[model samples]
Target: MSEHHTLYAAFAERIDAVLSALELEGALPPGTSRANVSVEPPRDPSHGDLATNAAMVLAKPAATNPRSLAEKIVEHLSRDPLIESAQIAGPGFINLRLARSTWTDELAAIAALGGDYGKSAMGEGRRVNIEYVSANPTGPMHMGHCRGAVVGDALASLLEFAGHAVTREYYVNDAGGQVDTLARSVHLRYREALGEDVGAIPDGFYPGAYLVPVGEAAAQEFGDRYRSAPEAEWLPVFRAFAVERMMAIIRADLQLLGIAHDVFSSEAALQAAGKPEAAEAWLRAHDLVYDGVLEAPKGKEPPDDWEATELPLFRSTRFGDDQDRPIRKSDGKWTYFGADLAYHMQKAESADELIDIWGADHAGTVKRIKAAVAALSEGQGEPIPFDVKLVQMVQLLRNGEPAKMSKRSGNFVTIADMVDEVGKDVVRFSMLTRKPEAQMDFDFAKVVEESKDNPVFYVQYAHARIRSILRKGADENFAPSAEHLGLLGEDDLALVKRAAQFPREVEMAARTREPHRIAFYLADLAAELHAFWNLGNADQQKRFIVAQDANLSGARLFLAAQIGQVIRNGLALLGVEAVEEL
Candidate 1:
């Protein structure tokens, strides 16, 4: 109830009370701000339970000695009921130890909350749009897009769990040059399907045979209708057919990984009929549209046909970007950036906060999107903010060798192939085991290896062991008694302490917009659970399913059940299956 009031909160509240009492909210000492206060568990448990640097931050501003100010703050915090003691430590840092019963009460609260132990209301129902895995409509999703897909889906789930109203979106680049190439490739396959001698695909076109079915379907649907038609006469029909089929394939691939988008915004539809002038109008209204000639190439000479011309540009540099970006080409064709600006503008109308999940190749594009948002919200009292997260590449390896790329998918590993080789649970969990910003190596052999080194299996095994303990307890007629909890020992206390920290961890991960934090936390929690179980192996009295002592077994069984439930809930949010019988 009321978020269970984490023990660290009291330490933070005490620091805030001291600041308020001193009336020092304006600014802060050099290189630090008064609002930079943070209370976290000490890295070294020997130091203390929690540590803070409020005194160090306020030292110069308050014109007091660092250690002396820390001593005063320690004294003020020692008066709190939750704190057992507060000590002034290294360089004016205050380390606090909480009463043992505080953790005991936290365990009881976690048991009461059950599956909802770590749920928070921090989001306050704010709407957040998460656009991710908007892969090109040319083919199925590959391994490169897997990590971002998992991260975006898990982050969206984490936000929802933390009380945010989130919209999951997928942007389709159907109107781009790639999709146009897709149409021509399908036409080649269409002729082959019609029994024509279209041997091997020529260079500069898609050589993947995955489009064979698409071509066959088109030929069957419109027999001889577009066989002799000009490219212009059939481009529209073929492009629509090819894109729709590719999208179906992509959707199926996402389904294999348990990901679904709430909306699939198309670049074609954004400017299809009457929306082309919309983006230009908005740009002109914001004065971001300008006609300028870009400098010619420095390292290599341009083609003889290349000519200098003035083009419309968006002043992205005003929003902390490196330089201005072009919105249109000299041939009067809208560049990719122009379509993206319109897409984001359309997204802002529906959601106040917009977040894009893109590959590292789009790192240079981040500033322009932010600049467009600022320009669009220039005069409005309420402005919509956008954030773009660039996910680095994932190199898939197997048996210490680079995995062979499938030519059917055009030099990439499809998500379907990945999930088929590795189960959905392993693929989803392993992908998110690290931060999305970090470049990850997905070693197929190690992921399937059954050991602690494999986080997915380790966590699943922990849940399975918990279930086995409960089943054994049931066979021994061990049901938790109200009076049995008094038997909780030192090992039990340690387990409960880690369990009680779940809510605080969830809040931190959600606030930081990082779902990998959950993955890492679950790994730690699993280790603690496994360690606690191994302790039982060395000592008969510590066993959770003691045949001789039903009362002791009852208390331990309840704790084990609680652990299994928490692990299940957390893994579910990450889109990883939690098996009770693995």
Candidate 2:
């Protein structure tokens, strides 16, 4: 792979070198921490191309005033051929204006690197296990799981682009009561398949017609053997069969949205292997677990049936949980927390880092699970970085009102149905238009609208328009050439500057674990491209294709091609298609 040196990264190195030279010259103290020094675009673009706080950050440690230090730094910085000028702004900040050749060189780099333009090495190949859309294997995926699914998948891609070895995973909750209920529901359908009336699905049972096929499949394979057996004999058989069939359905739904997990861990299988028991034994030896009685429930109206019972408890409160949590119930079965802790420990064994994407309803459980991982890390003598990102619910709407539910999933709109209606690109991109912690509405009518108001459309349209311009140039016998790139002026470099931000944006987004930043950046870049294209409307000489001047037109075409490549690269990270034509 070719190494990509982004404009921002290149300049950051230059600033660091300048600082190092200052230290050697005895103008500053030795071994001063540069951790806080940063290079970024000036908030006001009119100030300069790039801004850094190296002087301000190092001033106190060097025993000098910031302005005095900045002047010394700028003296060395001004000597670099790539730097046109360096000036000290307000107390200590340094702003730099790059030589025009610098941007032209970056544009040349963009052309040479093509799709690899914004790729970074920030992650340095660490293994990251990201679990998302682990909705119970109960039914088809619904809108409730849609946001986190897209967010997690996009983050995984962003990390990979930033040079991380990422594993996409899904946790199957097949051991819980939900799967047991699913088994009972499928049993009713099995009876119906075997010619029983099986009237309306009773309360507490799944009512979706999607399970009818699972029941028919079961009836075909098992005949009438377990059909008439006791609940004990049939529950296990039906549960396994139902879970397998439901997982197939979930996989199909995820595939429709361009998502596939590298691993699907089963809770039942984890229990069968006694992983939870091993986790409990280790925690007990480490004093992280003990036998205790939990206090009665605390509330404005406490439960009348609340009772205290001795159980194996985890010392979660020591790590910031409101109270210690129970690892097992009075009946000897592991509680959900016990199983989840074991699952995370299993994940930590192989991965350098762990991330879980869950719904907002799971927010209350975050602290305990984090405490478990912290305890496990303490026992192993190595810290395991764990983060749980909660995605707020998305309300599905048609036009302006709440959308109708799918008959297939019973109460919620299935992911398959949404993708079928709007498209995979629209569904995936719409899910990431807002921050995951903030609630959002997915309006069917608004998302599919073909206008600037729709972000996906706006960005895709930009790529499409660039292709159209290239095609027109080809038809007019004009080929894009870097030979006359010097013919391009300031208005054109503004677009180059916007496109150049992609690498910096990618690194920042990956560091923050927010893929939406890529989407936001692409939207702004598209706006810049569109604005630049509009300049041709008022003045014939400003148009991308100047019939009288092929050299200028060729240079402009080359610029447009590189901008299109950036749009494609950003959309690829979000898993959205960049259409060549509308």
Candidate 3:
């Protein structure tokens, strides 16, 4: 979508042009749509550089068979100067092999673009709000919350690269039962700070040692002010103090993994501002919410205390949810979903798109929120697109065995612990190796290993190796440039083809909102660099640093530099550093 067009986009445009010309000649139907037509790299590289199903998609409307239509399209495409050859394959696909000059041109473009090589204007500056790692401020973030943080962060980076004005956000569940418990625990520590006989933390209170510091800090700040006060007099003050302290801990923990949210929206702030009340009133006017609900949820045993109390419920069933969701509990308290919807409603007013990253355990909640967005659009005029990505759990492993709790946080393995065990780059890259929806194991032993199975090390090693080769070339007065890029041969062209795919890969991944694809791509690029390096081990002529041939050395070194730059860019999106040394 950028002003600087990539080869993939160019080819797609050319195919569209060909179809437009066919329409002019009445060879194809006048109103044939080409929106679904796509020109992409062939599944098998040996078949061709690119393939398109344009012929097949248009053949039905043209009143012609796919084979004959493909032949006609190929006739026009073969005349293109950039295309070496065009042939019909399968039932209707048109395969194209681009001239070698095209690959060289793309490499030159990569050189000109540098860090911005794979960037695109696909997002068109639309505002995107991405909320991730909304972990309750009850405790420090553990591996339970790490995947969502990494995924959301990477996705925000990816969208920005693809030209979106993205805001990375976190929701503070300060007005929750969990935070109240956190306050109670802090109070115990606060009492202990006053040298009281608060012997041991009860079973319900948080006993993590991390809060000891918070208690000490609170006691030093306010001496015995709440020691004898009633719950009404002290709860609010203590809750405010504790939530701030808990957030500080959460922010520091997120920083260990290179995450810092752009905004931290508070549930307490929303409630205090009467946002939920306003949302409920608006929904009532639209008939989206009503006083209803008495049926027990299926598959769950009814609690003995359960009563058929009429409560206010959202008409989520009108959309995709299985049943109406209660917005207010029987006790007249707003449900978590109701408050969350108000938070999302806040998001809708400012952004063109809304994306929430949540744990897979919250999968049942996706539909209701989506319904809320739809209902909001119905009441309002404009639409705000919303999507929720669920990240599954990460099982911690050490030496091929399940790793246990963190000594630092007490309850679970904290993100800080993982970063301490194996640096941030390893933690970030390893978390992204799998798609968010699929469960994965973070094997500390394997992640740090120097082998192909270890993507973090393997990919970084490639960049480091390339840097070494470039340094050697630097000593020999060999410089890479577009002027010497023409020395590349068949295998060299293959490498360029792979490099050129970076832009297309970035665009596709951004379109799908899948940043994991970027990690997979970097791994493949690393493999190519390593495989090409191995060729140097067996043959001296294939070496990047050749004292006998300065021209060849410059060309090969140029290719290496481009590969390294791309690796750096891809790793940057995943919030991992591209190390020059392992």
Candidate 2 error regions (>4 Å): 299-302
Give the per-residue lDDT digits (tens) of candidate 1, residues 357-462: 8899888878877888767655444778778888989988998789988767768888888898989999999988888889888988999999998998999999
Instruction: Give candidate 1 regions above 4 Å deviation.
Output: 1-7, 10-34, 58-80, 273-276, 300-303, 320-322, 407-410, 480-483
- Return the TM-score for each candidate structure: 0.91, 0.98, 0.97
Taking every candidate in turn, the Cα RMSD to the unseen true structure, in Å, is: 3.4, 1.1, 1.6
- lDDT by residue (1-582, candidate 3, tens digit) is 335676889989988888888899889988788887988999999999999999888888899999999988999998999999999998999999999899988887887788898999989999999999999988898999999999999999999999999999999999888878888889889989888988877999998998998889889988999887787787777889999998999999999999999999999999999989999999999899989755865557887776688988999989878889988887777899999888888888888899999999999999999989878855667768899999999888889899989886887998888889898889999989999899899888999999998888888999999888888788878887567777887877888899899988889999999999999999998898888888889988878877798888888888888888889889998999887765
Candidate 2: worst 10 consecutive residues by lDDT?
A: 299-308
- Of the candidates numbered 2 and 3, which has the greater lDDT value? 2
Deviation in Å, model 1, residue 546 alpha carbon: 3.6
Error of 3 at 494 (Å): 0.8
Candidate 3 TM-score over all chains jointly = 0.97
Predictions in order: lDDT: 0.82, 0.93, 0.88
lDDT of 2 by residue, 141-188 (tens): 999999999999999999999999999999999998998999999999
